[model samples]
Target chain A: MLTIENLHAQVEGKQILNGIDLDVKAGEVHAIMGPNGSGKSTLSSVIAGHQDYEVTKGNMLFQGEDLAKLSPEERAHKGIFLSFQYPVEIPGVSVTNFIKTSINASRKAKGMEDMTANLMLKKIREKSSLLEIDSRFLSRSLNEGFSGGEKKRNEIFQMAMLEPKLSILDETDSGLDIDALKIVANGVNKLRSNDNAIIVITHYQRLLEYIVPDFVHVIFDGKTVKSGTKDLAIELEEKGYDWIKEMV
Target chain B: MEFKEKLLDSHLAFEERIDLSDAIHQTRLESLKTFEQKGFPSRKDEAWKYTSLNAMVLKDYALFPQTETTIQLKKVKKYFLYEIDTYKVVFIDGVYSPFLSDTTHDGLDVCLMSAALSKAKYRSLIDTYFNKIINKEDSLTALNTAYAQEGAYVYIPKSVVAEKPIEIIHFSTGKEKALWLQPRNLIVVDQNAQVQILERHQSLKEHVVVTNSVTEIYAHQDAFVDYYKIQNDLSTASLIDNTYISQEKKSNVRVHTFSLGGKLTRNNLNFCLNGQHCHSTLKGVTLLEDQQHVDHYTLVDHASPKCESHQDYKGVFSEGSKGVFNGKIHVDQLAQKTNAFQQNNNILLDDKATVNTKPQLEIFADDVKCSHGCTVGQMDEDALFYMRSRGIPKKEAKALMTYAFANNVLESVELPILKKRINKLIAKKLGVNLGFDL
Candidate 1:
């Protein structure tokens, strides 16, 4: 569902991602793990088509469509989702309204009519409950004065609403408690199907315990140094990135 | 003759038509002298530096309209807050339209200024409140005073609450080729009284019309007053409004101005806190496009101790539009423990748009809290990116941000229907039909 070859990216004259290669098929979960400043989050931003990150070399293709020429919104309309590490707090826009707008905007881009109000309300209620969120929280301004756990849960709620084909979770578990992590993981797990893919980017192996990836890759100095199965996550969790740095 | 000379020439004919023996006549004569000395403000004046009226003064206008044009109620009903009951004082072509007005005299006065000035019962009110709070040095205010004879007159008796809101509407028909109007208003809320008023000036057609209006409001001990001004007219019309408000002990007053469309608009809103523990709120939302100009000059004078004032103004300018905001907060020596804050924020949607914002704070009191700041720029790029990445296109994202930027001021509106109408106006102005309200 997604392919990248030697993806080289930089932001504002400074290099972040260099010589990165990755390929993922449908119905699989990929976990990219690294230490601080190891370009784990940069990979997610690059895939999401953030304007500040300019791809200097190589290309990214999603379902055989080159994403380099597409805008962030265009990428989104093509079923791509990136959960931000630090979501922007927008005042005066309620969470339900924000999610509804996002859903309808995507539908409109696909030449589809808007979902009826009753259906939208039902979907919001069902998805908000899946994340263990109170219905009252949906009416507050989007992420305004929200706690870390609430913001993360709300981001997952939006993901559940949009139902993208390729989902990128960047540092999603950093701000969540154990229960919230389980709920978020369960929500993402339920949305996984035969025609979709998931990429979980994190700094630690703690999140892998909940969402169990099919493959694990360690990125160091903007390059994927090693590709292994789930046991590599446990070993890295115990011994730390020193061995990985030495191997690189 | 020039427009200024025409005004000075027509005042003689207007003087011969009224009862010159009244005390207000003396005020008119003195004000006429003041207007004669100071003429119209030039670009050299410090307050008029950013806003120029050179071209406006060069154009000719009929000082007095020739006909009394009456408009049908069905034609102007949409402009009113029809969802709720209101007492209306409607005017057309600077003349009162009795057929369209719904006034009251049972324990309150919601009627015409001319009747208030001439009647024996409203004599004390006219003597006590009329033309008392306006600045003596303002030349345009002086011009309005020299020709002030018609407008809305509202008086709420002591401890009495006005049963319904009042609507002061002025509609001008393009009967004259080029017309000018000056209307005066006086409102007095006695001790512990309460009232809400909405004022608007609308032109029916695309013609040259200028309105120089003045309004004075007095709030006695423990009284409350909520005043709203809606300035949305055709590009051919211009307005200059001078509003003065005085509050006594424990009184609360709020004034909101909405400037959506006009060729040129100037709002001089001033407030004086005369007694202790008084509160004043001044808020405005201005959206302009296509060579429009709107200037807001506000002043809050804290004369007594333990008084507070809050001023917030926001604007969105697009496509060769211009906006100006000059706010001043003064704290007297005796006014200790005074809290005052002012904020002016603006967004320019086009490279040709311009905004000049200045905040002046003069503090003399030993213990006071005063803070003022202003910001002028485009929309936030990061916020835009965030919304756009959520599947909203660039245009819709920009509109949503702009709407949210100016939406907070409407949250404080007490009337839901009026707030909804203003919301629709703002959405229409942004030219975006969002899936949901922002």
Candidate 2:
């Protein structure tokens, strides 16, 4: 579903992702485990076409098309979703309105008619119920005054609504409690299909227990230093990142 | 002659048309003398530092229309709030247009200022609330009072709620080569009465038209009044609006001013809390592009105990447009436990766009709670990117953010149709097609 070869990137002239190479097929979950400042978030941002990050070298291909030429919204139109670590607090736009706008915008870009109001509402209700979100929560301003757990759940709820082909969960477990972590992981598990892929970016292996990844890659400094099965996450959890730093 | 000198020279000709023996005529004579002494405010004046009337004062303008012109309802119907029923007091080229007006005097008096001034039955009301609240020291207000012959007059007696909202519209039909107009309005909401008024100034064609308007509102004890001013005129139009509001015990008064388009516009809004527990709210939203200019000067005077006031104004300027916001809050020595809050925020879309915001507070009461804030900034790039990443294009994203930034003010509008109209205006001014209604 997605391929990145030696993806070198930087922000504000400071190199962050020196060279990241990753590949994932449909129905596969890849976990990029790294400590703080390991460019995990930068890689996701680059994939989502964040204007702040400049790809210094290499290329990213989504469905055989280069992503560097696409804008953030264009990339989104091509079905790439990035769950932000810290969602912005837009005080006036309600969650329902925001999601409706997003859905219609993507649909418009694809030359499709806007989703009927009834269909949109039905989808919102279904997805929100899947994530255990209250109907009242969807009427409130987007992410404003939301608790840490609520924010993460809302991100997953947005993911459910978008139904993207490739989704990047960037540190989705950092701020969630165990119950919320289960809910988010379960939601992702339900959305997973043979036509889609998922990249789970995290610092701890605790999340791997919930939605086990097919391949676990250890990223340090910038590039991947080790790639193994899900057992690598358990080993790293027990040994800690200090051994991985020494190996680098 | 220059417009200022022409105004000073036209006073005698104006007085010849009105009754000289009336008591209001004497007030007009005094105001004309004051305007003659203070001519036009120069840039050196502290209050007029950022706005200069030099260019406008130099133009030659006809004080009155050369010939009366009639307009079909089809031509200017879109300017009215046609979504709902309203009592309209409309004027064309500073002259009252009875054909286009929907006035009533049944339960409440929703009529014209000229009738209230000339008729003997309304003499007492004309005497009591005519110039009671306006500041005599303001030269522009005094100039409007000197030529205060026409506008809207609304009176709700004690315990009576006006059945319908009043719409005061002034349309310039481009009958004269260049025109100068002064419209006067008086609204008296007696004790326990309630009223809502919407005022707008429009120019039908691309001709120079300047409207110097003054409105005085008196809210007695337990009265409620809502006033809205919509200034979206043609590029050749300019407006100077002076509105004075006086509130008594337990009264509530709110003024919302929307300045969307104009060559130059100035709003002088003042509120005086004369009794305890009065509430005053002043809000404004300004959007300008090109060389358009808008200035909002508001003052809230907390004179009695337990009074409260809130002032909020937002502005978006693009290109070479200029915006100015001056909010002043004053708490008298006896106004203990008074609460006052003022906030002004501006977004400059281009490097050349300019905004000057000033919050002036003078508190003499030791037990008062007063706070003020002012900010001028560009749109948040991070927020923009967040929206864009969600598949909303940059233009639509920017427009949505701007709408959200200005939406909070519209949320408080008591009239839903007016709110919807202003929302559409904001969206149109931003020039973007949103997926959903704003």
Candidate 3:
């Protein structure tokens, strides 16, 4: 469903991703793991069309569409979602309104009318229940004073609402407790389908234990240095990243 | 001659026309003298440093309109808060339009300022409350006071609650080439009385009209007053609104000013808490684009002990628009245990759009809590990107952000219909229909 060849990207004057190649078919979960500043988040941002990162070389294709030519919103309209590592705090926008707008926006881009209020509300109720979110939580300002766990949960709830074809979870477990992490993972597991794909990007193998990936790619420095199965994640968990640095 | 000189030269003719009693006539004469001495404020003045009236005052405007222009009720119905029944005092081209007005005198008075000044029944209320709290030294207030005639006069009797809100609307018909207007309003809410008032200055057609309006509100013991000012007019029009409120023991007064239009707008909102346990709430939302400019100068005087004041103002500017906010809070020595808070936040959508905001606090009391903060910035890029990545286009995302930034201020609006109207107006100002009722 998605393909990248020798993808090279940079932000400002420095290169973040260089000579990286990846391929994922439908129904596959790909895990991208690296230490801090290993271009893990940069790769997600590059794919999501963040204007700051300039793709200097190579090409990315999603469903045969040139991904680099699309804006962030266009990428979203094409069923690409990025669960931010750090969600922004918008003080006056309610969660329900934000999600409604997001859904209607994509619908409008697809030349469709707005979703009926009743249908939208029904979908919101179903998704919020699936994510174990309180109804009151949907009415409050989006992430204004939300706890760390609540922010991540809200992101997952949005992903559930959008039902994107490809979901990028960048460090979704960093700020969650064990119970919240389990709940979040359960919600993600329920959203998985045979036609959709998710790229779980993390530094540790803890999240892999819950949402086990079919493929694991270790990115070192600015390139993907190794590709393996889930066993590699357990191996790296025990040995740490020193061995990967030695190989590089 | 300059506009100031024209105003000074025309006062004699203006005085000859009004039914001026001795006391009121003397006050006007004194105010005219003050205006003549000070003329218009200059950039050198500390309070006027950021805003200059030189461009506006350079050209001459007609002191009085040439004709008695009348507008049909249906033609200007949209300007009124007609969704709900309101007692309206409407004016056209500086002259009262009796056919367009719905004045009342049953138990409470919601009529004209001319009647209050000339008629014997309302003379005592006028004498006691009119011009009582205005800053006589200020040139613009003095100018409005000098030409004060024919505006709204609302008197709520003691312990009486006005059954309906009052709307004071001044509509300029563009009859003259360039017109200048001075409207004086007197509102006296007696002890335990409650009232809500909405005021606006609108230009019916494209014309150069400048309205210098002064309003004095007296909130007696236990009284509650809500005042809303709408400064959305044509680009050729301008408004200088000077509103003063004096609150007694346990009185609550709140003022909300929405500045969305006009070429040059300046708002001077002053509050004086005269007794203990008084509460003052002041909030505003300003949205400007093009070459428009708006300045807000606010002062809250805490004269008695145990008083509280809350002020919040938010502004959004795009293009070459400009904005200014100078908020000052003064706590007297005897006014202990006072809590005064002021906040001003602005977003500049364009690099050329500028805002100068300052918060000043003068506290003489030892045991008081007073805090003020001001911020001027552009929209958060990360927030913008986050919204865009959620599939909202850049323009719609910006509109939503600006709307959300100003939505909190509207939450305190007690009138639901008016809030909805302002909601539509803000969305229209941002040029987006977010597909849902905010």
Candidate 4:
């Protein structure tokens, strides 16, 4: 359901993702494991249509459409979601309001009727409960003064609400404790379906142990050097990324 | 005639056209004479440096005559605060319309400024504080004080708390070439009393009208007063308003000014904390677009000990508009333990849009806490990207972030109805509706 053909992207004149090729089918979880500055987060951001990143070469196809030509909002409407490494704190915009706006906008784009406030509140409560997030967070400003774990949990909760066809978790394991990581992984796993795909981006194999990816790709220096089963993530975590770099 | 010559001729004609009767008119004539002596201020004047009245002086705009086109009272009935049962006063073309006003309250007294000046009980009070806060030496202020005709008078007795807010609506309506109306107001809250006042300035015509107004407020010892000014005129209109607030011992005062309309607008607000333990808050928000220019200059004076004051003013300028904010706070040596804070933040949405913010603090007391900051910037890029990434369009994202930027100032308003109205007006001005969820 997702394909990246030798994607090359640059941010501020510096090439970060140099020739990244990846493919993920529905009902499968793919983990992209890499060290810092390995272009792991850049890959997700470029696919999500971040304005700062320029695609110098290569093409991205999601559901058989050119993803590069689509704006970020259009990409979102097309059922592509990126769980940010660092969620932005939008002051004065309550979580409930922001999520409602997003949901309505997406629905409007798909020619669906607008969701009522009562129905939205009920759906948000259900999602919050499923994600183990506190319902009180719905009233507060989006991620404003929230703890790191709370921010990550909020991202997972958003993913659960949107239910995108392809969900990319970019470094969701960072800044999370073992318990929070397990909860976030469980939330992602519960939302998985036969028609949906998941791309779990992480630096360590700790999150992979809970999410259990079907395909584990070792990304070194912006390229996927090794592709194997979930055991590849465990082997890379034990030996570190240097061995992968030497092999590349 | 040449524009400058015509302007001078108009000034001379206005001087010769005065028909003075009472002491108030005589005092105003003296102010007019003072303005004649000073003439129109030039760019040489320090305060008039950034803003030039050269257009006003050199354009030879025609002065509007007294308008008899009666305003339909029902046209403005919807804008009044219906939730609060308060005294309502209406003015059209700077003249008080008694037919449109209701004065049935026992503890509150509201009347035309002309009538109030003739009364013996309020004569001295009006004469003492009318033009005291504004600098008579300043030419424009003197000119306003000179041409001042009709206004409102609100007086609350001592130890009596007003049950409802007082609403004053100033409307300008005429098809004349150019109209200049001066609306003056004096509000006196007696000791230990409490009151809230809302002054809304609007226009019904598309004429090039100028409404120069002044509102002076006196909060006596232990009194609490909330004052709000909303200006939403047409693009062909210009407004210059001076609001002076003086707080006595232990009094608490809050002033909110929202400027949403007019082609050119300037607001000068001065607050003096004259009594120990006095508290004051001055907040203003200006939303401008389409070459509109809005300027707000505020001065907070901490003259007594243990006084506290806070000022936060924010502006959003788009479509080649310009915004200016100059806030000054002064803490005297006797005002020890005084805490004062001033912040001015502005967002410029377009490349051609501009904002000039200057926050100044002059503190003589070593023991006071005073801080001032100013920020002129565009919308947050990360916030915009975050919103857009969530399937919200770019325009909607921008509007959302800009609304959030101005929400800090709107949230400071204590009244919910007024807050909702101002938010709607802001959204209308910004040309986007984020709905009531904000």
Candidate 5:
């Protein structure tokens, strides 16, 4: 569903992602583990078409279509979703309003009518309960004055609402408690399907214990150094990324 | 042969052609003499430091004659009363047209100031408050009071709250080379009465026209009044508005000014909280494009104890437009426990667009809570990126963000229909449609 060939990206003329190649097919869960400066987050941001990152060289293809030419919004319309590391807080805009706008925009791009308010409320209620998000949270401004756990859960709630083809969770478990981590992981596990792909990027294997990945890859210095099965995650968890750094 | 000499020569020539009324002719002459003595305000004047009226004084604007002309009422209805049902009073070229007015509300009195001056009951009311709150030191106020030949006087009696809003539409239309219009209005709300007044000022002609308008509002004890001023003049037209509001005990007063179109526009709004527990809210939105310039100066005075005032003003400058916001809040020594807050925010879109925002707070009582802040900046890049990342185009994203910014003021309006109209105006100003339902 997604392919990257020797992708090189930079921000302010400083190279971040150099010669990164990765591929993911449908119905698979992939975990990319790396040290602090291994370009794990940069790779996700570049694929999501963040304008701040300049793609210096190489090409990224999503479903056989070149993704470099598309804007961030266009990439979103192509069913690419990025769960940000730090969710933005937009004051005076309710969560329901923001989510409705996004869903309507995506639906419009897919040649579908906007969901009615009644239907949307019903769907939101159902998904919110499943994700353990309080109904009152929907009335508050989008992520404004929200705690770290609430913001992460809101991101997962949004993922459920958009139902994108490829979901990239970037540091989703960084500031979450164990309870929140389990809740977020349960939401992700429930969302997995045969027609969709998931990419979980994290530093520790704690989150991996809940949402088990089928494959794990060690990233070093902007390049994928090793690829293995789920057992590789446990091995890296026991022996930190320094061991992988020396191997690279 | 100098620039000032040539400009004064042209001004005198235009001044010679103005024919004043018998009642105000003497006053007009004296005022013009005063204007000549004072001349146009320069940077030497404390209040005129930021706003220079030199350009206006240079252009000799011709005075519009008092004549009855057929106005396209349909266009007025389309723009001002598209969605609401209310009593409408229309004035064309500063002359009241009884044929164009619709006054059908119960216990409501709307009459021309000229006619009201003749009645025994309203004469004293008109004479007592006519230009009373406007400062004589203001050259523009003196100019409007001296030149105003006709105006409207509206009074809502005690214990009577009108069900519908009263709409006052002033249109400037003439075939003359240049036209000068002075419109005056005085609205009084008796004790415990409620009213909403909307004043729409517009000009249809492409020629240069100058509009000097003044509106005075008095809210008695326990009265509630909401006033909205919309200025969408022609490209060559200029406007100067002075609005004075006085509130009594436990009364609530709100004034919203939306400056959308004009070559040069200046609005001064002043509110006096004279009675205890009185509340005043002043909110404004100004959007200027091209080479347009808009200036807004607002003052809130807390005279009595426990009075409160809040002000929020926002401006958007694009292209080569310029905007100025000067807001001041004054808390008297006797007005302890008073809470006054003021903020002026601006967004400059283009490189050449400019904004000058100054928020002033004067507190004579140390026990009062008063805060004032002003910010001049570009749009939030992070917010813009976030919206755009959600599949909204850049233009749409900008419009949404701007709308959100202005909505902070719009949400405070109590009337739904009026709020919706103002929302639509803001949306149009931001180059977007009013598709979102609040």
Candidate 6:
């Protein structure tokens, strides 16, 4: 579903992602784990076509189309979703209204009619129920004064609504407690299907136990040095990333 | 002749029409002298620094329309808040249009200024509240006072709540090549009385119309007064509005100004708290585009102890439009335990747009809480990106953010229909269709 070949990216003349390559097929969950400053977030940002990051050497292809050629909104319309580590707080726009606008915008870009109000309301109700979000919470300002748990849940709620082809969860488990973490992981697991792909980017292996991945890649010094199954995550958690750093 | 000289020479012709024997005529003569002495304010003046009236004052406007012209209500019905029942005191070319006006005297006085100024029954009212709060030193207020004749006159007796809001609208039909209008309004809410008023100045067609208007309001003990000014005229119209309000013990008064259009507009709003526990609120929202300009000058005087005042003004400028906000709060030495807050925030849509904001606070009391904040910035780029990543276009995202920025001030609007109308105006002004009602 996605391919990255030797992706060398930098921001403001400072190289962050150096000679990184990865590939993932449909219906498979991939976890990219690394220590601090290991370029895990940069890889996710590069895939989402952040304008600040310059792809110096390589290209990212999603469904056989180069993402470098598309604008952020264009990429989003093309089914690329990046759940931000820190979401923005728009003070006066309600979550429901914001989501409706986003959905209609994407549909408009794809030359489709806007969803009717009734249908939009039904879908919001159905999806919000899955995330255990109350209707009152849906009417509040988008991420303004929201708790960390609410913000993470709101992110997954948006992912569920958009139903993107590739969903990249960037540090989605940072601020969540054990209960909130399970709810968020359960949400991601439910949204998994054969036509879609998931890439979980995290610094720790705490989230791997909840949403078990098919593959785990350890990135060190901007390169994927180790690729293994779920047991590698347990071993690294027990032993720590110092040995991995030494090996690299 | 120059505009200032012509105005000075037209005083005799103006006085020939009104009663000179009345005692208030002495005040008019004095104000006319003051206007003659001061003339028009120049850019050198600190208050008029950012706003230049040179271009507007250079034109030769007919101080009075040559003839009386009538208008059809059907043609101008949209200007009024016709969605609900309202008492309308409408004017056409500085003259009251009886056909379009619905002034009443049923318990409360919703009538004409000309009547109140000339009638024997209202002479005491004219003497008590007329020209009482206006600062005679200012040339613009003096100019309006020198020609003050016809506007709205509202008087609520003690403890009486007005059933419907009064709508004071001035419409200048493009009959003359260019025209100048001076409208004076007097409102007095007696003890425990309550009133709501909405005032607007609209020019029907593209013509040079400048309205220098003054409105004086008196809120007695325990009285409530709400006033709204809607300045949405054509590109050829300009307005200079001077409003002075006086609040007595425990009175509450709020004024909301919405400036959306016009060539150049200036609002000088002043409030004086005369007794203890008075609450005053001054709020405004300015949205300008093209070469349009709007300046808001507000003052709140805390003369008594334990008074509270709030001032919040927001502006959005696009293209080469210009905006200015000078908010002044004065706490006197005798006014102890005064709480005053002032905030002015502006967003420049493009690089060419400009805004000059200044908050002036003069505090002489030791026991006072006064804080002022002023900010001028563009829309947040991160917020824009967040919206765009959600699939919204950049233009729409910017519009949504601006709408949200200006929506907080609208929360204090008590009239639902007027609030909706202003919301529609803001959206249309921003040139976007928001997904939800703002």
Clashing pairs in 1: none
lDDT (tens digit, per residue) of candidate 6 on B1-438: 899999989999999888886647888888999999998999999989998888888999998887888898899998899999999998999989899999899999999998888889998888888898999899999988888888899999999999999999999889988999999999999999999999999999998999899999999999999999998889999999989999999999999999999999999999999999999999999999999999999999999999999998999999999999999999999999999999899999899999999999899999999999999998888788778777788878888888778777888999999998998888888777776776
Per-prediction tally of clashes: 0, 0, 0, 0, 0, 0
True contacts kept of each: 0.63, 0.64, 0.81, 0.66, 0.42, 0.68
Best by lDDT: 3
Cα deviation of B386, candidate 1, in Å: 1.2
Model 5 / residue A171 / CA error / Å = 1.4
TM-score of each: 0.96, 0.99, 0.99, 0.95, 0.92, 0.96
Give lDDT for model 5.
0.81
Judge the docking of candidate 4 as incorrect, acceptable, medium or high. medium
Candidate 2 regions exceeding 4 Å error are: none
What is the DockQ score, from 0 to 1, of model 6? Answer: 0.73
lDDT of 3 by residue, B1-438 (tens): 777878888987997888766348778888999999998999999999988999889988988777788788889999999999999999998899999999999999999888877788776777788899999779999988888887899999999999888999999988888998999999999999999999999998899999999999999999999999988899999999999999999999999999999999999999999999999999999999999999999999999999999999999999999999999999999999999999999999989999999999999999999999899999999999999889999999998898889887888888888888898898899888988666
lDDT (0-100) at residue A195 of candidate 3?
A: 91
> Residue by residue across A1-248, what tens digits does model 5's lDDT show?
99988999999999988788889999999999999989999998898888899999998999999999998888888888888888888876788887887888777778998898899988899889878998889989888899999999998898898888999999999999999999999999999999999999999999999999998988899988899988999999889998998897
Model 6 residue runs over 4 Å out of place are none
- Per-model C-alpha lDDT, please? 0.90, 0.91, 0.93, 0.82, 0.81, 0.91
Which stretch of 10 consecutive residues in model 4 chain A shows the poorest summed lDDT?
A217-226
lDDT of 2 by residue, A121-212 (tens): 99999999999999999999899999999999999999999999999999999889999999999999999999999999999998999988
In terms of DockQ, which candidate is strongest?
Answer: 3
Residue B374, candidate 4: C-alpha displacement in angstroms:
0.9
**Counting only residues 3 or more apart in sequence or on different chains, how many pairs clash (N, Cα, C under 3 Å) in candidate 6?**
0
